[model samples]
Target chain A: MAIIDSLKKISDTVWELPATYKEGMRVPARIIATEKLVREMDETVYQQISNVATLPGITRYALCMPDGHSGYGFPIGGVAAMDVGEGGVISPGGIGFDINCGMRLLTTNLTLDDVKPHLKEIVDLLFQRVPAGVGSHGFLKLSHSDFRDLVEQGARWCIEHDYGWNEDLELTEENGCIPGADASKISERAIERGYNQVGTLGSGNHYLEVQVARPEDVRDKDLAAKFGITIPNQIVVMFHCGSRGFGHQVATDYLQTFLKVMEPKYGIKILDRELACAPLDSPEGRDYFAAMKCGLNMSFANRQVILHRIREVFSEVFGRSAEDLGMRMVYDVAHNTAKLEKHSVDGKEKTLLVHRKGATRAFGPGHDEVAARYRDIGQPVIIGGSMETGSYLLVGTASGADTFFSTAHGSGRTMSRTKARKQWHGKQLQHDLEARGIYVRSTSWAGLAEEAGPAYKDIDEVIAATELAGISKPVARFTPIGNVKG
Target chain B: MPYQYLEDIGTADIAFEATGRNLPELFSEAADATMNVMIDNLGAIEPHDTRQIELSNDKIDMLLFDFLQDLIYFKDAERLLLRVRDAQIDKKEGKYFLKAEAAGETLDAARHHQRADVKAVTLHNFSVEKENGGWKATVLLDI
Candidate 1:
């Protein structure tokens, strides 16, 4: 039987894989997707999510969002919350290697009419200013000790250094700096790899795009106006990136540490080596958590600096200061991260370690953690699509607590990069996008070819499923007008 | 080519199978495969700079895993694109030790045709085994 056959339908958009379907499962596995998407999902996602279900102290259900796909230990778009007081285990695999890899959106006063004539110039300048691709380095020059302070301080450091406006921090997740970042727990190699990579857009599905919200794409006019997407053809800038090499090295260093101690020291046996973990309160777990926060801070700082450079680029191009251009931030949301959040479990309030790997936290309205400005409307969720396709701006729904207030991250990959490269020529794709009025600049032809629109699932379909599932509600859809691909 | 990318294994990352006649050869071939994912033209990376790598692990598979991560470390930390020129693997005190010489230059996008920025080596289905009287390793690189 197909794996889909084993899933018991819970709703129009939710399916459940009972714990009995897999041995050693602590809880059932649930996937949030429409019937069509569930059938089209890669077989490995089921296996991987089932593996995730077996981890220690997992609560409720191991959840997979609509954009779920096969990843190493947990399926991309996987969400699992564990009760720390109940011997909950924290796995590096659960948060992913690129810690806090997330999306950021900035609303601009310009419109398509204002930007069309200067699309190429803006994109080209962004491509140059925000270095992209493999071996790309940012313009920042920080000493070893300075780098340590930056990670500990996160985007606040950028504000102090004049890289961002002070108001920007309030709109960012965790006020742009996660607490408990101990540079002492991080490896020197991680610091070395990361100190110079601040502000760079790393390659493989990462991009900096300038988009527009046409009137027709606004699904909820009231909500759209609240989120600053009111102007027809309103131009906005969005980008996806993470901690770069710094996060990768932090995860790698801890993965090695956990592997050496997981079984012998902790007596925890995992089916996959990548699922290696330790108890949340264990010494190894606390150290990794602290180091991981450093990765989170590094990324927050990374995007903060990129936003600074972006403000400069836009200012230089349009002959107006970024402030005069009204480049106010919408919100920044992290897709890959683990956070300690308070949620009601079995009708009792509890602090849970919520792990969202390739998933975004969609905190509903009135949540205490929601930014004060958005507390009434709920947290804004930024879902990035492929460069050829468009993206969406959604707000968390009150009903989203079902999966610990988590939702889909992107129009997740439907094909492999190697296969996409084999199927499309980069130059031709670039020409095609240009003919359609979407201008692009990329560092590698092969990299561009690998991210063709057809290489991913339909963005509209993914959005429709999320809305139908009530995990997040669409506020507006933005069409890409210009992009800088890494 | 001692290595070939596995097209069907991973949809979001790059996976490859590498083979060699001996332990050292296996390590070198895997190193080349990992670097090849980043730079399309591995041969263009001249041996302008060199670094010696020394790592030991109780498990043989992790030894290969560590060696591959070391290559990525150089690319990220030093901007050096290295390929293992030679390697020696030995067993002592129940641990496997690897010592190797790697050579390459700081990455020049104008000279080196870059591809995806490989993030890390994932041990999901990662394996190193003796196959058909030679050594074979299946690896996945997070890009």
Candidate 2:
């Protein structure tokens, strides 16, 4: 394993490795982390990040978010931008298997006190109402035609089906849809795999949590007021999930196809097979992008349906209509994805393909891309911590634009899941969380054990690093009171 | 050979370790294990035509990923039942060059049982380490 020695500290939270550090690297690799966090990283992360720097047409810097971990080709919390017109490459590893796996936060009118007596019931309701665990299927089964429309329409399909509110679409990244999703490009196997899994929380680290809003952390007072979060101790529902099997199949299908086409037709030389790619303008690349968009849309639609199901459960359990109970979407954001955007490079505005594997877009206040409601306050960046810890809602800042308006997505794991299971017992961890008022329900005990608090870095420290790095500022803190794990 | 479940990282994860004398044998064993995680049997697929795949990577682990990806690609795209026939790996200055031959036949649902279509090889908990004898690799396939 190669070690990165003598990193030049750019600031209190930013560190840089110049391009001369490695041969064939087009840009420098920038790591956003504290000294302690940097030291804890496995050598593999360094190798992967450096390899990412060597990618074709990568611009400015190959950036590492605070939650960075050793990934296949690009580190999990990796960010890289390439000039689209200048022969940029699109690697599947950069987008990840889960595609648009992301976080959605919803605020409620009820306070923590109002739900104290029924916390367990609410948790049970969510666990039952939301399909979870491996191979879990939802009630929403769709035909090929319906699935194609869902991919083309995204959350708009859900809204049309009356699964979500129209306003919710406005608050979602890209208005809950990405254009140019060609269903024809997606393979039949990929479509079949996703047919019954849409709206299901297929297993592994995906979860739904019930949280209480902390009074001290509401930074956007006006926005909070507009969202009706005026009272302290208010309860909220936050969940993290994504495109599920559909995304995975699309990624798998395309990665192999890309590898086959990369050398023969495109004349591309790859540093890593896991970083299999094709030029963004190539037929293979365009097809993958279209397929990827389908995955993104499927996830958006899945989440919208899950949100509707949650609303139904809450209404049934609390004896109040969802509208009266204040079940409304605050915002939703995709953490693992690539988007075509305009950014200034060397004082010239250039269109680029920005891949954010485990990073979030944090467009600053007043950006036209931001929703009309949140344009004045910046985009809401949801950072989900481990189930046993607290999640934070942050707003994008001006400085974030320098890095294409992106920030760390979560706490990032400090220990591997295998290591965590070996070190701790799931049942014991469940007991401890319950003792702390966090009701835990999971389909698999072993899975729960792997996500123990110790497996992850402290989210507070990760958020603090982001704040100090001037990428995003904390808007609110939400401590989980109950959680459902798939 | 059978894959023994090592541990679970979360709800759907089950880690396993397998061993073989050579690259082809090791990949065959690993594929059997991955399929075992999803279904019951791999012995059902009939042996058929040999397919050749030549891949090169800067690192051995990536070569492993590509090797497995090729099998998945064949299974999904070509709808064939693939099993490793032969494999050779050469490494120099950190780069791994590989040539592999695999065999697969037409899938008969009555014999070959289809399980979850593995979506992609995940970076989550992916590893390839050299052991005292040959090479030991661990990967998490997103199913």
Candidate 3:
């Protein structure tokens, strides 16, 4: 593809497509990936990033993370920072369909050995209580008023309902809640979609996993200790999900609104209709931002409630209280979102709306957004890989702030889920993972097959590239023992 | 011809094209294709529960988008798995309206086997067109 020929090697871990390479690009598009990964990427990704570059108020660079893959409007691993002062625009496509779709890590004092015999029961109990699969629900009834407050208060509301500990909020992004959330902006249909799915794990790529960290996998022992992970085979719980239909509706509502007004009113032209957007200061833009906060908060509460259910299952299985078992949250990161943050642009600080579609914000040390305790160390960035491949833990670095404090979210899909399914049988893939010391529990076997390890880029290479690029510092690596996929 | 899954589409998402002799038949086929993505055995779904859905838009494309999204909303909201049994598409003044009565029972793990949970019908590569003598529309769902 011409897009491949246009890419110029910037460094060992970075590539750039200059503005001159594209017709309407206002800024260069920078990609953080190894040479091999770059070559493997499709031309559609290049076109999408350049399309983002042409948008109004986009500054610095239209950044694509290492796991970058072609997506609807922006590449899945895309990042863009737009200046409101410069008429920065907000695109629902930029924020992604699953708003605040993120990762949350919880550490426990217990190790793999402590739960060896009861592994099946623990995993089974988790799958039972969490309500996995398509169109799933439980008895988490909510009144109209309660639903409104849940979106406004986020995980705090669930904590008040005894779903989790108060400390959980502190570890979550935006303290498990965001400001400027107006439930009035949300539609009744959106509220209804989120009502029954508060604690549910929606299908496809969303899962609750139980993993163990080996001491050998710990890269920074000091940083690992600070995160309450120091021992080999230290059991940890990590969940990957989002706001379910709630977030989808929020994005849908705004995309429709933006679609109707983008060209005629905002005068923002986009190559793909999926990239519909409005100026960040417009009424439509403000409405989406506010509604997105509800989506973000809904996800925060969803994961918090899932965490609560996990703690209860562990407490019951181990015959001890959750706290007694030392089930402490490590950190929660919203890998999908657009937040207003002050970033140094050309050595001058500017408030920008940084949209991290499939990228994680890796705020370095001294940034106030990092937890007070972690302000010195840095924000914890959790990367969930394929079920068979291991995951990684990294901390933001000073050198990483170039792309508005962002890094790769996961091993971007190298192949399509359909290709994966065509290559491997779900039951056979489960057997293969089992042979490799991982347990898989999924509602749909076809879904399980779609997520086969080879379907994604190598986690080790992706993390290595991120570390080498100084975007994030590696802390630890985790291997899954049990995974619950919806 | 009713509808058929577009297997040639990308690996991660799903798409289908529905054809009908008329607008309402096309609407029914589109709904069938959308619901089939969740669970393929339409005959297995007992039509014991019925939900009425009504949507109107100035554009036929948005009307179809709204109709499909409405199915998903009900799926997530009331845990309902429905297929359109009867549908009508009409033009009042300049606005297009769709009214459909779909019948299906609540999702039961004991009965219906689950497939991919379509997050939403994405606008990416989405289109509704008039082809040959009937109407044809293609939609891609973000699964």
Candidate 4:
């Protein structure tokens, strides 16, 4: 309570903890949220974000987005930019275990009425086609070498292999493939763990859903139409997942490497073991960066393949070709990543390594990084909510530079998985949801119970904070009609 | 049961405490806690297969860390659900060494009532210590 009281309110939606709040901090820490959300935030988030402030090369402030919650070394929704030339370091904790763990949205011309009768059929087919749950493997079985190729080429490889449309790449962040990925940097064990996991909707909060946007839900009808939400009761498919075991292995392998040398060789002592990092210029850091890119690409390919599967299911259930149904990609956004980008620091533009763990990159309008087609409208930001509550589609704002152009990724969890499971029975919840017209399918009943809407913070409030802060603007809200939970 | 899931910590992940009378027992208990996060029914995992594990680390904590990571690796790589059996830990020349056997069957979703997927072991608040003349460990798993 004392810590919360100490926060200096900068605005109704922004609070700052001065550099003096903790010892060894190089910069202040900021939490972007309304007063109520800040009051309800877990205490660990403050400690974690403060710890992030102490990392070398952290510039401006260590920030937590509106959906901030307790995570490992960096709070979920944490954002920190390191001055690469000023002793900035790259930490695996800042990037997260599920590298490039992100969201992808696809728009279809079909309205709610057209999809209502076949919701269950479409969801069931997707559940089977897109592997889900623990130890689940994707349908794409690649050899060790081909798997290496896939990670390097990313979604481009999927297109070459006939898993996606050519346009899908243009709509993906970084064109679905980032540069500097080297398969040789990845460990053999990591390869073994990730090779068959290209298209899986891994368990523990990963999911695929069929959502609808009613006319009233479109807050900015013109903006929503520009991003493919043109039809009333428009049907859209969105899924949250990442590189699976491959990316986890990549982060694990690098974290252990960094921990071994962070203090001894690099002289970088971290407050928490999970915050292990190496200087951006160090051999260890460069190697991990290259390897992390592989993980990033792997996730792009994973989503690309999953999109192909979704198209197949929709076409099958509706007895029409995917193109005929107007299945076009809205956008794909990665929630966890570290990338080098130029931004204003001290009124001078400098290249900084921005780390967004459990946060989304929200580049504003006219930025070259925005896809060419979307340059005039800004980048699309997909924010996933709990399966039961629905999700939102937002656009980056010019004023988002306050946090280096980062925003909340999801409705951050408010309860632990065990507690949620104990409180909600998955079977009963499923039936209850079905009665409300939201058909549900999951790999495990217990996993379903853990994701009950009550376990998470209010998504609308989180979005409202972002808008007030001028970080991103909401275009439309989507209510789920069918879901495939992992 | 030697292990119990911790409710107050790791709101976004799974956390648990495992206790044992010795290092070997501590490692085994910790392994069970990790696997339990993925599969709810440990008894349902039959010993239809076996894996031998050998690892060593200068720090006792990392020794436990490496052993638990090996189990998760097998699960993701081969879909093998395992339980620790006959784990042996010894310290020589200030370095800790672990040797063990793990047994279970390849995961069959139809038979094994799966739970949340445990991504990896996080070092956040992860510890191995002596408590009340027994070895105790706490682990938080990224899910």
Q: What TM-score is obtained for chain B in each of the predicted models?
A: 0.98, 0.83, 0.95, 0.98
For candidate 2, give the lDDT: 0.79
lDDT of 4 by residue, A328-383 (tens): 99999999999999999889999999999999999999999999999998999999
**Model 2 over residues A256-290: C-alpha lDDT tens digits?**
78878888998877666768888898888888988
lDDT of 3: 0.88
True contacts kept of each: 0.76, 0.12, 0.52, 0.77
Sort order, DockQ high to low: 4, 1, 3, 2
For residues A29-64, could you state the per-residue lDDT of candidate 3 as single tens digits?
999988988888877788889888988899989999
Q: Which regions of candidate 1 deviate over 4 angstroms?
A: none
Deviation of model 3 at A63, angstroms: 1.2
Using Cα atoms with residue i matched to residue i, what is each candidate's TM-score against the true structure?
0.99, 0.85, 0.96, 0.99
Report the lDDT tens digits of candidate 1 across residue range A1-486: 988899999999999999999889999999999998898799999999999999888999999999998899998999999889988989999999999999999999999999999999999999999999996889999999999999999999999999999889999999999999999999999988888999999999899999999999999999988888878899999999999999999999999999989999988888888898998899999999999999999999999999999999999999999999999999999988989999998899998999999999999999989999999999999999999889999999999978999999999888988788899988898999999989999888888998999989988899999999999999999999999999
Clashes of each: 0, 2, 0, 0
Among these predictions, the greatest DockQ belongs to 4
The TM-score of candidate 1 is: 0.99
What lDDT does candidate 2 reach at residue A472?
94
Poorest 10 consecutive residues by lDDT, candidate 1 chain A: A223-232
